[model samples]
Target: MSVSNPTLITFVIYIAAMVLIGFMAYRSTNNLSDYILGGRSLGSVVTALSAGASDMSGWLLMGLPGAIYMSGLSESWIAIGLIIGAYLNWLFVAGRLRVQTEHNGDALTLPDYFSSRFEDKSGLLRIISAVVILVFFTIYCASGIVAGARLFESTFGMSYETALWAGAAATIAYTFVGGFLAVSWTDTVQATLMIFALLLTPIIVLLATGGVDTTFLAIEAQDPSNFDMLKNTTFIGIISLMGWGLGYFGQPHILARFMAADSVKSIANARRISMTWMILCLGGTVAVGFFGIAYFSANPDLAGPVTENHERVFIELAKILFNPWIAGVLLSAILAAVMSTLSCQLLVCSSALTEDFYKTFLRKTASQVELVWVGRAMVLLVALVAIALASNPENRVLGLVSYAWAGFGAAFGPVVLISVIWKDMTRNGALAGILVGAITVIVWKHFEVLGLYEIIPGFIFASLAIYIVSKLGAPTAGMLSRFAAAEADFRLNK
Candidate 1:
C-alpha cells in the first residue's frame, strides 16, 4: 500500500489543475448570479456532464462497486433504480424546471424558486426548504468527505485524520474560490475522468481474468448465488432498491445544472448526453464489482483490503491491475468523483445560505461582489461542518448518502414535480407536502419501519399530502396565471 512517486505526482497535478480551474471560474463570477448559477450560461455538453458527475459522486466508484463486490448482482438494483429515476427526472422535470425557475423571478436556488413559485409572502416555504437543504446536504457533503478520506487513506497509507482533511482541502479550496462555474467546469473534467476510469478498469479486469466466460466461471465457482439477482433479496427489498429512482426529482445539485443551462432547448440534448454517460458509467461500475469477484478469486492474496472494506474494491483493483503511473490516473478518478459531487454540494449549500437567507433577510441590498464573497465564505463554513461530521472513520459512504438522499427525495420530490406540472397546487399544499415528506423520512428512518426504504413512504405520503391539500385549497389567480405562462414557455421551448 505504499504510495509511489508517480502516483503522488499525478495526485498533485490533478489537484492543482482543479484549483486552477477554480481560479479561472473566479474571473467569470463578477455577480451573485454567476457565482451561484454560472450566470445561466452553460452549454449542453457541460451541463450534461456536470449534472451526471455531480449526481453520481464517489458512490459510483466506491460505494456501488463495493456493494456489488460483496453481495453480487442484487446490489445492481440501486443502479437500475437510479438510471430509471434520472431519466424520468430529465424527461419530466428538467426542461420544465429550467423555464419555471426563470419565469419565477430568475431564482438562483431551490428555496428561492419555491418562494417565488408559490408567492409565499410569509417566507415559510423558503425557510423550511433551505433548512431541509442545509440539514440533508451537510450529511450528503459528509459522505463525499468520507469517500475522499478513504481514497487518500488507502492510496497513500495516510492516517485517517490526515487523510480526512487532505481529501477535503482541494475541493473546499476550489469551491471557495471559483463558486458555481468552477464546480461545473471542473465537473466536466471530472466526469470525463470518471467515465474513462470506470470503463477502462472493468475491461482490463475482464481481460486479466481471461475474458467474459472465465470471469463468470470464476464468479460462479466462488459463489453460485452470486449469479442470482434475486438470491438474497425479498419483495420489499427489491422495491426498496428501486425506490432510489424516486429521489432524482428532488436533488438540488442535479436540478441546479438544469437551471444553469443556457436555454431550455439545450436541455433536450443535455438529457440525451447525460443519460448516455450515466448508463455507461453505471454499467462499468457494476462490471468492476462483478468482474472483481473473478479477479480476486484467482488472486486471493491481493484481496485483503477489499475484504476488510468492500468499498475499497475499486481502489484495490485499480492499484493491482494497472502500472503505478496508469494507476495514479485511475485512482485520481476516485478523487474526481469525490470532488465533483462535493464541490456542487458545497456550492448548493452556499447558495442556500447566501441567497435564501443572508441576502433575503439580512442584506436585501447587498452588492454583487459582497454576496459573491459571502457565498465563498459560506462554502468554507459548510465544508468545515462536513469535515467535522466526517471525523468518524467508520461511516459508510452509501449509508450516509442513502439517508440524505431519502431526506431530500421525500421532502421535495413531490412538491417539485407537482408544482411544475399542476397549476392547482397551492402554497399551503406545497408546505404540507414538504413537512409530510421530510417528517415521514425522518420518522421512518428512525424506526426502520417495515424495513422499507424511507423514501418510498416519504414520496407516497408527500404526493398524497400535496394532492389532498391542494384539493382543499385553490391556487390564487396570480398563481394560476404564472403557471400558465411558465407552461407555455416550457411547451414552446420543448
Candidate 2:
C-alpha cells in the first residue's frame, strides 16, 4: 500500500505545523539574544532536544539509513560512538562552556566568546575564527540542503532542483523571522516527531515481516557480508566513520546551545535526555535500514537501485505499512532532521558575520538594529551560496558532511575542551589547533585517508598540534591561578 490520500494529508499537516511553530516562536523573540539564544533561558528539555536534533540531521536521515541498508548491523557501531561522544560532551563541555561564556560577558556567538575568553583584544582571533566558521558552515548547510532536496525528490515527485529552492526558502522563512529561538523551539517539536517516526516505522516492518530472527536470516541469505561489520570497511573507514563522533566538540551551532543555557546544573539533566534520544532515534534508524533489506527482499519491488541507496529505507517502510497519509506525516521527520540542522547552521553562519566580524571591526558604532539587518543579509548570502552548491544533485550528502564534520571536530573540539579547563592554554595554541585541525581534515580528505575516520585522525593531529605548540610556546604562568580564582569569585557572587 503505497502512500495514499491519508498520507498526503499527514505530510501537509506536518509541514504546516513546522511553519506554524516557527511563527509562534517568533512571537517570543524580542531582540538578537532572544532571536539567537531563546533569551538564554531554555530549560533542559528544549536544550537536549535541540542539541540532539541539530546534531543528527542529514547523517541520520540519509547517511545512517544508507549505511544500515548497505552494511547491516556493523553500522550500529557508529551509533554507539555518536551516543557516547554526545553524552561526554554534555557532561564535560556543556556545563563549563555555558557558565564561562555567560560569566565572561553576554557575547552570543562562539567566536565572540572565544575572542573574549582568550583576551584577543585586537579582535584578530574573533575575526579569524568567524571566517573559518563561515567557510565550514557554508559547506555544512549545503549538505543539509542537499538532504532536504533528496527527501523531497525521493518521497515526493518534486524535481531535486525545485525541491532545493523550495526547501531553502521555507527554512529561510522560519529561520530569518524566528532566529535561534524559533530554530531551537521548533527543533524540539521536530525532534519529538523524528523520534516517533524512527521508533514506529521499523517496529511495524519487523512485525509485518515475521520477526528479528527472520529478518536477520533473510539479510544473511542475500549476502553474508550483510552480517559482516568489517566487510569492505577499513581501519581508516572505521576510524573515519566513528571519528564522526568527534565532531561534537567544536560544533559552533550545537555548542552555542551550551553557551545560552539557563544554568550549568541543567547540563546534567540535558545530557541524560540528549543521550537517550540520540541512542533511541539513531538505533531505530539503523534498525529500519537493516530491516528494510529483508522487507523489500520478500517483496522485490520495494528494492530499487542498489549501491546502498538505502537512504530511502524510511520512505519505503512508510509506504509499505501505512496509508499514504501516515507515510506523509512520518516522512516529514527526515525533513525535520535536514531543516532543523540547516536552520541552526544558517543562523550561526550569519551571526559569525554580523556579530563577530562586522560589529567587531567595520562598525564598532553599528546599532543593534543595523547589525540585526546585517545578520539578515548574511543569511541570504549564505542561503544563496549553499543552494548553488546543492543544485548539482550529484553531491553525496554523507561525504560532504564527513569532510566538514571532521574539520570542525579536529579544529575546534580540542581547543574548546582545553580552554574551559586549562588556563595555561594560550591563544596561540588555540589558533594553531584550529588551523591544524581544519587543514588536516581538508588535506587528509583530498590527499590521504585516515585509518578509521577522518575526524578521529584530524582530532589526534589537531590535539597534538595544540599540546606541542603550547608546551613549546607558553602562556602567562600566573594566568591559571587567576582563572581559578575568577571562577571561584563568580561562583561566590552568584
Candidate 3:
C-alpha cells in the first residue's frame, strides 16, 4: 500500500533496458545509412511504433497530463487535434515520401530530398533548409532534454542540472552509436514499454480508487470543470491549444521515418498501427492524469505538495496510488517518454548535420563510415548545447515544444506541402516561406496576441506568398510538366 523497494527495482530495470537496447543497436551498426535510416528496411511494426513513440514523446506524458490537471477536460481537445492531424499526415505524407525518396535515388535526409526532388540549380535551398532544421530542432531537442532532467528531479530528487547532462549523455551515446536504425529499434522497444506503463498505471489507479465509473463520478463531483470538455478557455484559445496538430506536416523526425520505411506498401499498415497506438497511449496518459485528481481529492492526507501544481501529477500519482513495485514501473514509463523523445530528436539533429549538410555539400565522396563519425560527433556537440540550455528544466513541456514546433511548422510546413503538390514552387519561394515562417514564430512568441497560434498565421502567410510568387516565376518546360503531373496526381488520388 505504500512506497516499496520493488518500485525502485522496477525503475532500475527499465533504465537498464534502455541502456541495453542502445548497446545492442551499437554493435550491429555498420555505417551511416544503416545508422540513420536502418538502410531503408524498417518493417511496418518497427516504423509504426517508433514513429508513434517519437511523436508522442514527453509532450504526451508530461504536457498532456499537466494540461488536463491544470485545465481539466479542456486539454483533451489537443489530443483530438493531434489524432486528426497524425492520421492525415500518415495517409498523405507517408506513402508518397517513401516512394518519392526512393525514387530520388534513395535520398537520405529531408534536406537531401528537398534538394534532389526539385533539382534546383542553386544549393541555397539545401543550405537554408539545413540551417532551419538545426535552429528549430536545437530548441526542440533542448525541450526534450528539459523533460529528461525533470524526470529525475521530480521522481528521484536529483538536481535539475545534473539530470540534464546525464539524460542527454545517455541518449546521445546510444543515438550516435546505433544511428537511425538503432534509434527506431530502441524507439520501438521504449515505445512499447511506455505504452504498457501508460495503460497499466491508469487501469491500476482506477481499480484501486474503485471501478471506472466510480473514478469518473469522483472526478466530476470534485469539480464540474473536470468533466467539462471546454472548461476554462475561449473558442480561439481552445483552437490554438489544439492547433498543435498542424505542426505534424513539417516535423523532420516524423517524416524521416516515412523516408526510411521498407516500402510504400507498408505505409497503410504503418498508418493503421501508429494511429491506433497513439490514441490508446495518449488517451491512457490523459486518463491517468485525470484519475490522479480523483484519487488525490478523495485522500487529501497523502496528497503532499503535488496536488497544488499539476506539473507533478504523474510523479505524485506514481508515489501515492501504487506499491513501490508498480510505482517503479510507472516511473520507468515516465522515463520511457522522456528518453525515447530525447534520443529521437538528438539523432535527427545529428542526421541533419551529417546527411544534409556535410555529405551533400562538403564531401560528395565521403564514405558512410566518415559520415557516421560526423553524426556521432554532432550528437555529442548538440547534446552538450541542450544540457547547457536546460537550466530551468521545469518549464512547461507543451510551451517549450510549441515554440520550436511552431517554428518548424510555419517555416517548412508550407514549402513542404506546396513542393509536393505544386511543382512550380520555386527556390525563391521556398526560401521565402522558410524565412517568413521562422521570423513569424519568433515574433509571435515574443509578442503574444489573440487568435490561433503563430504557426497558423505563419502557415497561411507562407502558403499564400509561395503560391503567388511561384506563379510569377518563369518555369522551365520540365518544371511545368512536373506541375501538371502534381495536379494530375492530386485529381486522380482524390
The lDDT-based order of candidates, best leading, equals 1, 2, 3
Q: Tens-digit lDDT track for model 2 on 162-275? A: 779866777887888778888898889889989998999889899878898888888888887887888877775665566667789899889988877787667788888988
TM-score of every prediction relative to native: 0.99, 0.94, 0.93
State, as a TM-score between 0 and 1, how close model 3 is to the true structure. Answer: 0.93
lDDT of 3 by residue, 394-456 (tens): 466778888888988888877767776665677677778878887887887778877568888
Clashing pairs in 3: 7-324, 7-325, 35-179, 35-180
Better of 2 and 3 by TM-score: 2
lDDT of 3: 0.78
The alpha-carbon deviation from the true structure for residue 468 of candidate 1, after best TM-score superposition, in angstroms, is 0.7
What C-alpha RMSD separates each model from the true structure?
0.8, 2.4, 2.7
Predicted model with the maximum lDDT = 1
- Clash counts for the predictions, in order: 0, 15, 4
Could you say which candidate leads in TM-score? 1
